[model samples]
Target: MSGPLSSLRVLDFSTLLPGPYATMLLADMGAEVLRIEAPDRVDLTKVMPPFDGTFSTAFSYLTRGKETLSLNLKEDGAADRIKELVKDYDVVVEQFRPGVMDRLGIGYETLKAINPALIYCSITGYGQTGPYRDRAGHDINYLSIAGVSSHCGRADSGPPPMGIEIADVAGGSHHAVMGILAAVIQRQQTGEGQFVDISMTDAAFALNAMSGAACLAGGIEQKPETGLLNGGSFYDYYQTRDDRWLSVGSLEPQFSARLCDTLGLSEMKGLALSQKPADQNALKEAIAGKVREKDLAEWQSIFAEQDACVEPVLTISEAAEHPQLKARGMVIEVDRGDGELQRQLGCPIRFV
Candidate 1:
């Protein structure tokens, strides 16, 4: 089926993960996204590994439905060509440091003057204007500054870094997409376009608001794996006898009781323990011992018969092949020339 954004035309001038991911979402929903690449610069996709020998799987996954256009903005007439294209486009997305676009003479101000109805979005580390606006940073740097890294990992271990580019994708790409969509809605009423300045640091802070609230409320300085949601006795991942993993989320009193009952730990029912260090550690260990008694599938069956909010953790490949995922079409395959098929995470929205 055609999508709501089918008629929207997007000019994507950003590169790497965040910008590409944002535009990829739009393209999946049928927006016409034209990716602008520099003619002289080697596509970083070529350098990054996990390549299928000829092209980067990462690049293929991100740029599936978008058209590629090579242009040298510094070359004569190239800037003018881009200006012409921008006039006809509904949205423009770019991810450069604060002054880089302005120096190039193609910043939002310059473009909006020509296309008054354009939704121009700029995604950056700090923001367009700030004390750290000129500072160079990446996903890790942004997350560290946002205080997100403070609450990650175990208490004994230093705050472990995230495996994925949380700030780049969650903070930058998702935030930029949200701003662009909001801008589109606002334009419908005001009959004029506006600039969207998205700061990766601000986005990361927003994502970490729940943890921030705990700190603000004078809740114990969130030690990793100790918070309500992190991994307490009632809510944690357990290793089964077969070495598979099962995740339990029985936080509420009723649910926690149900979990204990399901495991035949009736003696531990209605159990209340102090949040003190020693008490908490003992409780976590007691629960872990019970969970390790069975295989993951056995735990899955047990939880299925109860409302304990428990589940077996699946690997990426296993998740892709899962019945629920397949039924919902959450994993899709795209054909990329030469009889090659590429699989990727599918569009999350269901229009029903």
Candidate 2:
């Protein structure tokens, strides 16, 4: 906790992924984040799997480098006490349906009345004012509304729920962080704080930059498995002989040429993203055929010297131990309240 945001203090009322992770990034960059937990209800994340004797690995891992305070905000004096404490904090992050915070007497207006320079960030599925703002949603629903789900998964199978909470992490968490930091800078210049309205749906739509650009520029809708990076051509997953998967991301022409040469599919070198679906499918199948002829280990050895973005699809443990992440210090050992050093995700942003 000794980075750029060391002097800042964040008061977080976010329970699950979005707000917690946003504050987690801030805490990693040296903000003092105080998580205010509801006394009556259990944090759902605390009950999730991969536990160490009933302690949730996910919850413990995410809550590292932060302090928690349990309080019943419904209590008579609790809101007042919170307001008093908010006077000192630089930022406040909350993830509740619209008006919930206002009803609790802890809305942005209420907080700002007490501290004018407070940066209030509200993370929600739709936002604070939209029609869907009050509606309940998770990552999937947001992705669906943002048109991101339509471009995901295979075209034949239709869109499937992404394996990870892409919307929550990418849309909510990362966007909230960006908005909060931007607000921090704005506050420094204007000597005032403002509300950061972060909608997961909006963030997901923004993440559609690649597909969105093509759709706007070409006046064409993007179907699943049609975009270059979205499994359109040879730049996709191929099954190895051992049933393991290898991701082929040779999108650049040079890399595509190298990949084609490696697999003896030299004709597909320049047609990495052919407008003709039949041609693309043929090239993909040809590459897939070559890949399936070898086991994952054999292919790994064969591509050892290659600069292509081809690699085995690894499990979480394998990814944590991968040399790329290891070299970047993305996998770290941390003490998550057990007085023992346990493994958790590390700081991705390096100051240097």
Candidate 3:
């Protein structure tokens, strides 16, 4: 069956991960997403390492089902052409810094004047009209500025940068998609186009909602590896006998008790390890000892017999080929040409 967004037309004017990922999601839901690229701009994915010699896997994954068009916005009539194109499009996504689009004469105001029902979304590190609106920044910088990175990493360790681009993908792309959907719904009701100013900093702050809540309550200051969710004894990763890893998320007392029982540590029954730091450390040591006795598969089998919320940590390839993942169609094979099929991560949405 076709998807709900089959009738929608999206004009993607942004490059890189965030904007591309958002449009990719729209395309997956059956939107006709036209990706506008400059002729002179080399695909960053090509410059990035780990290409499969056919196309950059990043590009192949993110740009699926989208038509590519080359256009130079700086040209005299380019903005006019874009304005003409916007009249028929349901959404226009741009990731330029604030005022860049306005300077190009194709900003939300200009386009909304041309088409009153355009869902124009502008994504940036700092939102429009902010003190840092025009300041240049990337995903890491945005996360740091938004205080999202403050709660990550080891407690005693230096405040290292997060490996993933949380600000870009989670903050920028995901939020943009959500904003676009909301705007679409609002437009349906009011028949009015609205400008969506999505700031990565704001999105990052939203992403750290739990930490923010804790901070606001004057509880733990969200110290890394010391929090309940981080690498605490009750809920963390432990290395098995074969150097494989298992993640235990038995945070609650009931589940923690069950985990202790599963490991034959009945002495831990009456201990409130979660509340006491000394007891928590002892519990950690005990769990690590038990986990070290077996390989990851053995622990997986043991956990399957109980409801300890324990799971074996799988590598990317293993995760792709996992039975549950395969059954759920979380990994899909796409024809990459020349008789080769590339394994691409599937869309998470399961449309009923």
Candidate 4:
């Protein structure tokens, strides 16, 4: 069967991670995504290492099921060609700085004149109208500006660089996709499309979630190793005897009891719920000491049938080989445009 977004057509003008990722999601759902890249400009992903024969694995995965067209936007007739494509395309996703698209004569207003029903989504670092709109920024910059990196890492190390581009994918790409879909729904009702301005900094600021709410409403600031979910409580990762780690999220009372009983610390289970720094630290240390007595494999076997929220911390390759992921079919093989299938992470959205 065709995917849910079979009727949608997307013109992806973004590069690197954010916009391409958004288009990748749309393409996974059967949307016709045409990625437009500059002929002279080189996308870093295209030349990134770890190539699958001729194509970069990262580039191949991101551009899966999408058509590509190379065009020099500054050259004559380029804007005309884009305008022609916009007539048929349902959505336009761009990742340019503030007025770059306007300078190229393919800005939202210019395209809206051609296609009134065009859903134009722009993903930027600081948004289109902010003072930092013209300023260049990356994932780390956005996270730092949004107060995410401030409370993320350890107290001594400040903020550690993220393994993944959280601000780029979670903030920009996700919000852009959500805005585009929401605009599509609105367009269905009103027959007029709207502009979607997705700022990574803005979205990252919103990602504070519980911490932001508390700080805004309760005047409580969350620091590293201070928040319960951050690292304050015993509900954290512990190192095993083999030096491997296991995440323990036994937050609820019943789960905590089970975890404590399993670790032979049933007497100290009450300390798990204590908010006092001393009590929390004592319990955290106790659990850490107990966990270090056994290897990860032993702990895994011990917690196999346990109800507590305990799981081993697996590497990326290990995670790909995990049984749960395999059972859920989280790994998929997509064609690399040459009939060669490369393994990639499957779409998490499940439709019956």
- Which number leads on TM-score? 4
Q: List the candidate 2 regions with Cα displacement exceeding 4 Å.
A: 267-274
lDDT of 3 by residue, 1-352 (tens): 1589998899999888888999999999999999988887786864676776477888888878788888988988999899889989999999888888889999888899999999999888898986898899988889889887776767788467766788998899899999999999999999997989889899999887877888878675777766777665467889999999999888777887898889989898655354776777788888889899999988888888788788999989999988999999999887665467888999998887
Q: Write the per-residue lDDT of candidate 4 for residues 1-352, one digit (tens) a residue.
A: 1699999999999999999999999998889999998999999999999899677998998998899999999999999999999999999999988889999999999999999999999999999896898899999999999999888888888888999999999999899989999999999999999999999999999999999999999999999999999888887999999999999999999999999999999999889888899999999999999999999999999999999999999998999999999999999987777777889998887788
Model 3 superposed RMSD (Cα): 1.8
How well does each candidate superpose onto the true structure, as a TM-score? 0.93, 0.96, 0.94, 0.98
Question: What's the TM for model 2?
Answer: 0.96
Q: Of 1 and 2, which scores higher on TM-score?
A: 2
What's model 3's TM-score?
A: 0.94
Local accuracy of candidate 2 as per-residue lDDT tens digits, 2-81: 88999999999999888888899999999999999998988889998878644788888778789999998889998998
* Per-residue alpha-carbon lDDT of candidate 1 for residues 142-261, written as tens digits (9 for 90 to 100): 998998887777667857778899999999989998999999999999989999999999999888777788777866576567676665445678789999988887777778788777
Predicted structure with the largest lDDT when compared to the true one: 4
- For each candidate, the alpha-carbon lDDT, in order, equals 0.83, 0.88, 0.85, 0.93
Q: Looking at model 3, which ten-residue stretch has the lowest summed lDDT?
A: 269-278
Q: How well does candidate 2 score on lDDT at residue 237? A: 94
Model 4 regions more than 4 Å off: none
